[model samples]
Target: VSEELLFRGVLLGWFDRLLVERPSSTSLLFLPDDGRYARRGIQGEGWRRWGAIVASSLVFAGLHVGNGPEGHWFGPDLLPLFLLAIALGWSTRQTGRLTPAIGIHMLLNGLTVTLILLGASSS
Candidate 1:
């Protein structure tokens, strides 16, 4: 809940407003002249939206770098974390709300914790 609210709700939301809400050709070269990128919530079409998503996800993943074992900043973990962030951001973009993203985040966390616990118990 907190993570989604912070990352998807706040950070991603800010990006959408900055990139999508007030899109300008000068800022986004790929923007079409037809004003088709002016979507109400998510912002510009295709690449533009994807650009924001990727940027936000990267930031999210980068923040997690020092969160791994013994705070060693594992590089390999960043890839999977970035991928998860992308999915969460995409869900938030699709629904124009953070609820779905929160749900997905919780589900993933719960599943991972459960698997870890089960593995520990078995061993």
Candidate 2:
């Protein structure tokens, strides 16, 4: 709940509002100049929105380092976490709401815990 509120509800939400709500004269790769991007809503704004997603996802992944096993930064774990963050952020952006992101986060965490418990019990 807290993590979703912070990352998806706050950070990603802010980014979408700031970078996606407005249009610039900048022409980015894969973005059309006929205002078609804006017409498609979140698909518009090109790289700026993508930049926000990447930035926020990085921060989300970095924040997990201290909470991992041994409380140390694990380089190997960061990539997956970053990817998960990107997915969550993308969901939030697409829905224009945090519910889906929060739901996905909860589901993933639940599955992780279930796997851990299953592994422990089997052992």
Candidate 3:
């Protein structure tokens, strides 16, 4: 919950604000909370949107060091974690809410915990 609020909510929101040209009146992304921009296919703000997502996702992956199979800053798991962050960022942007991203995070965390409990190391 807290991670979602901080990373997906605050951190990504901050990046979006910086990259996007004046976000919507009520929300962080260009469109309103209604997620209108998604159907339009990220046309005008493609670079801005990807810029924010990639930047935030990089931070997300970097901070996950020692958090799982991605136990080091320089490790094989970093790429996958970065990719997952990208997916999470996309979900957040497409929905104009953190629910989908948070749910995916929860599912991944749960799976990680289960794997740990099962002593299934090495990704």
Candidate 4:
């Protein structure tokens, strides 16, 4: 909850606001545009939203370095973390909400922890 709120909610949202356009204007937010908004992903296309996603993912990966079992400043784990962060960011944008990203984060963490526990037990 906290991680998702901070990274996907705060950081991603901030970057998105800076780089992407709102699906609808604030003054007419209540007005419906059918499925248009739903299909829009994160609004702006091309490098705009991609820039925001990549930037946020970079920060996410950088902060996690040296923290986990395989984590290091320049280790093999960094690439996966960066890639995962990118997927999380992309999911958040696709849903136009933090819930999907949060869910993905939780699911992945659970899987990783379970795998670690299983490996330890096997050893």
Instruction: Show where candidate 4 strays beyond 4 Å.
Output: 21-45
TM-score for candidate 2? 0.72
10 residues in a row with least lDDT, candidate 3: 22-31
Question: After superposition on all CA atoms, what RMSD does each candidate show versus the true structure?
Answer: 5.5, 6.3, 7.8, 7.2
Model 1, position 39: C-alpha lDDT score: 51
> lDDT by residue for model 4 over 1-123, one digit each (tens)?
788788788887788788776555763478676766655654445577788889888889988888778656778778999999999988887888888888889898999899999999999
lDDT of 4: 0.81
Question: Which runs of model 2 end up more than 4 angstroms from their true locations?
Answer: 17-44, 70-72
Q: In candidate 1, residue 8 scores what lDDT?
A: 88
User: After best superposition, candidate 2 residue 66: deviation in angstroms?
Assistant: 4.3
Per-candidate clashes, comma-separated = 0, 0, 0, 0
Give a tens-digit lDDT track for model 2, residues 1-123. Answer: 899899887887677678767545464454667767656666556777887898889889998866655576877778989999999988888888888888889998899889989988999
Kindly list the per-residue Cα lDDT of model 3 for residues 5-115, writing each as its tens digit: 887899888998888764455655434566555544467578888899999999988888567554565787789889999999999988999999989999999988988
- Top-TM-score structure, candidate number: 3
Q: Kindly provide the TM-score of model 3 when superposed on the true structure, using C-alpha atoms.
A: 0.74
What is the TM-score of candidate 4?
A: 0.74
What does the lDDT read for residue 120 in candidate 3?
A: 58
Model 2 steric clash pairs:
none
Task: Write down the lDDT of every candidate, Cα atoms only.
Answer: 0.80, 0.81, 0.82, 0.81
Candidate numbers, best lDDT first, in rank order:
3, 2, 4, 1
Write the number of the candidate with greater TM-score, choosing between 1 and 3.
Answer: 3
